[model samples]
Target: MSSAGPSPVRGGWLDPRKPFKDGVRPRKRQLGLALRDLCRLLHSDEPAETGRRPLKQAEAAKRLGCTADELSRYLNDTRIPSQDFLERLHKEAGTDAATSGQDVGITLEALLSLHTSALAERQGCEHCQEMSGRIDSLIQQVNAPCPQCAAHERRQEVRRRQLRRRQQRKLAIRLRSASKEQQTRLRLELAEVKVTVADLKAELAGKLATEAGLRERPAAAQPAGAQLPVPRRPGDRQLSARDVSAARQLVAQAEELDGSGREDLAFTLLQRSTAELLTPAETALVVVQLRCRERDRLADDLIHVYGRDQEKQDVMAVALELHEAGAPNDAGAVLRAALG
Candidate 1:
């Protein structure tokens, strides 16, 4: 404790002549400063008292065949020049001295070497090495698949298929149930149409009897060749029994098509029945009922499917039509339930 150890160096305790540890590289700022200093030395006039003037930055850029901005950026260490540009710069700086019969200077080579060394030092930096490692890890991660995520995706796909099958089965069952009910309803409606047709025939016969009685009373006052004009009954445009039977057959076929999921064909058949066979009231009732049933089925399917906004739109359209056709209460309730 009494004896003093070797006196500390003036700047710090570390020896001035000691070398750095292995794999050490100069920092970017230190390298940049060194490069800038070398640039100044190369670009300055050779002798202080000789009255020779160094080229201005613009003139120097002209000699090097580059823009003043580019040269300035290179000299300030803000940009790294290409190898060809550096070679041209070196040649341009030395060309004047060689032509004037003066010794070419070492400054140009020194600056180029400093710039190259600075680049090398930056490339070898610890931060750069760490960045390189991270880039490689990212590349490997991108190339290789994760087993857990892959398995999870596979399981999700399987579950999706299973759910779709379940929904389709449920839809098919509902379609069968609806078809049976439709058939029963159509039979009952056909019986009613038959009864109505019978009543219309009876009414038409009564009208003919009255017309005959009036014609008989006027017969005494009429000429021999003149014929009486027949009166038209209200039920003259009503569907006949044959037309009703045809409509019933078409309805059955349409329901079969609907059950088999050929709804487009079913609708086409229904339209034909409406246009050619069923009376106006019968057509309206049948079409409305079919449309309502189809809308209900669509709603059920939409509940379990993806991308069903269009189906919902179709449901709204049908509901609106039903409301316009005089079932406002039923249509309003359907719309409310659907919106809910």
Candidate 2:
């Protein structure tokens, strides 16, 4: 699922869990640098064009197979994304990780922390190599003439086979669902075309088999003057080129933050930047970033007004205090509810 848009931080605290899962530790400097870079995107916003929809957090969590809390934590800056998560983001969002400054050169082994020193390099944890080496030695012993691991491997293989079958079945179900949706859209388009042909036949006053009401016919089948698809009267503001350009630039800024070091800032900025125009969702982001996020005092004021929630106002106040005291996450969620 797509991130609600934008990066929150440049690089202060890389989610320790991400690199650990990848087997690498985040560099402190890299984390700090990144946070600083991404914080700038918090400053921009514009309106939206019709038909561009953003994925909600609940939907995103469901798609990612993560608990909403887990998704929120990752999103709300409690958890940093793993390499796998980043790959998923790139694949799903049509976002180029490199453009977002996610081109870290941590190797497959380093990325996975397969080597002891790799752990040391990322985490500054002393003697990770010794720990990795010990694990390796244990594996070696397990595979020796004593051999419990061989039996274990055979059992694991069987479980792996069962899991693969389960995955295939699920994939087939999803593919069928998607196919059905495509068919529905195609059918609608065809029906629309057929109505157009019938209307033309009717206009020529040739007897044609057809339904008799204006509302019953597809708008496209009506005479040229007929209205279609919620006819745009005046004041349907379309987004301009400058607005689109700002969004692109903001996206780049957010990415640089992800790479440079401030992920929290990147996440926040990403949210703000992605929705330049306001939706209920965008308004929510603005409300969160502008009124609530006191932690980023150095942060520009992006929100316009507060909707009436005493708890939200209180939360915002508390959050700002936390940020002033250097606790950003606490401040961020102070306003963003546990759900919604």
Which number leads on TM-score?
1
Candidate 1 lDDT over residue span 1-340, tens digit each = 0112222233311223323334334433333443232233234345664664545557566767788777655544335667687666556545554544444334555556555655765567666556545755897899899999999999999999999999999999999998788667556654554564456557657877987887877576777897785764322334345434544555565666678776655555554344433444344345445555564443233222211222455345545544667776545654565665
Off by over 4 Å in 1: 1-135, 138-143, 175-180, 203-340
Indicate the TM-score of model 1.
0.29
Which residue runs of candidate 2 sit more than 4 Å off their true CA positions?
1-145, 206-340
For residues 1-340, write the lDDT of model 2, one tens digit per residue: 1143354433423232333223223332233223222222112112563433334446555655666666544433324546575444434433323344343333234323332243354565556646755766897877677456678888999999999999999999999997687556445533443454344335433321222344567777788886533422222223234333333444444445546655545555544332322223223333334323342431322221122232354335444544554546544654454223
Model 2 scores worst on lDDT over the 10 consecutive residues at: 37-46
Quote the positional error of residue 91 for candidate 2 in Å. 51
| Backbone clashes, each candidate | 0, 52
Could you say which candidate leads in lDDT?
1
RMSD of each: 22.7, 33.7
TM-score of each: 0.29, 0.20
